[model samples]
Target: MQVTFETPDQPDVHALIAELDAYLYSLYPPENVYALDIASLLAPNVEFAVARDAGGSAIGCAAVVVTPEYGEIKRMYVRPTARGQGLARKLISALEEKARAQGCSVFMLETGPTMQEALALYERMGYKHRGAFGDYPEDPLSVFMQKVVA
Candidate 1:
């Protein structure tokens, strides 16, 4: 497996994003969802990462949207067949390294309450629970988390 920074417009990456979007929408109402779209992922402030298998098929993806103050993780997802291989962890590590390179002091994210595995992963990765940041308002369904990028 390999991970690299790339534009989110690639066909495989688009398909994966669609799948992720569907899954998240199913888990949470539209007002409660906070995922970045392809255009948003391609914006100047955001950096997208794609993980590909040996065959070069896009198997997972994540993005970091950097601002002057901090970086926010977005659109993190692994193909169902690709889970349990540490791809999510690897993708996040890559994002954190990129954020550090860009001088971002903190890394943050918001996941849904139903995503227990994701919450556990974020906790294991040193992200602590926090209040909503950026444009997100306080919502009962949102689980906000953050970690210093030191």
Candidate 2:
């Protein structure tokens, strides 16, 4: 899968992010979904990446936020039929590249313990468990992790 970084105004990108957000919300409760929506990912410190097929279809997307302390990952999703094809890894790699370009030294993410596959993927990608940060409360369903990006 090829990952492409595009402007927020790009057609279908925002909608795709919304679809991914909704999918995540359905997996975990709304209260446990800590990250903000697509508009939030467009902040000065935030950026997004889209994974497209060889024919140029938007098959997946992920977002990254660069902070002074670390890089935070958000909104990673591949189409239902696209699972197990390494698209998630591509999206993640693109996000990490963007993070490193912005001088971020570490990467953080908040997912859910119920999402075993996602947790495994993140761990395999070098993200280690971490305490909740930002506005996240001590919710049992929430799982936070971070990676020191090279």
Candidate 3:
């Protein structure tokens, strides 16, 4: 498997984002979901990466939205068939590397409490619980986390 930076407009990436959106929508209410749309992923400050299998099928994706203070992770997802193989962890590591190259010293992300697996992964990766950042406000349904990039 390989992870590479890409725009969200690619057909496979677009389809993967659609699947991610559907999955998130199913897990959280509209107000609690904060996923970035394709246009947002194309923003100048955001870098998106996709993990592809040997055949070049996108199996997972993640993004880092760079700001003055930190890089915010967004739209992280791994296809169900691709789970349990550390693709999510690989995606996060790739995003962190991208963010570090951009001079970001910190990384943050917002996820829902219902996503226990995600929470566990973040914590294991050294992200600590934090209050909301960026445009996010305090919400019971949102769990915020951050890690200092070494």
Q: Give the best candidate by TM-score.
A: 1
Tell me how candidate 1 scores on lDDT.
Answer: 0.93
Under the 3 Å rule for N, CA and C atoms, how many clashes does model 1 have? 0
- What ordering of candidates by TM-score runs from best to worst? 1, 3, 2
Displacement of residue 144 (Cα, Å) in model 1 is: 0.3
lDDT per residue for candidate 3 within 45-75, as digits (tens), equals 9999999999999989999999999999999
Specify the poorest-scoring 10-residue window by lDDT in model 3: 1-10
Q: Write the per-residue lDDT of candidate 2 for residues 23-68, one digit (tens) a residue.
A: 7778887767776665677788878888888888788888888889
Clashing pairs in 2: none
- The lDDT for every candidate, in the order shown, is 0.93, 0.82, 0.94
Better of 1 and 2 by TM-score: 1
lDDT per residue for candidate 1 within 1-150, as digits (tens), equals: 999999999999999999999999999899888888888898998989999999999999999999998999999999999999999999999999988898997999999989999999999999999998988899989999999955
* Ten-residue stretch with the least lDDT total in model 2: 30-39
Runs of candidate 1 exceeding 4 Å displacement: none
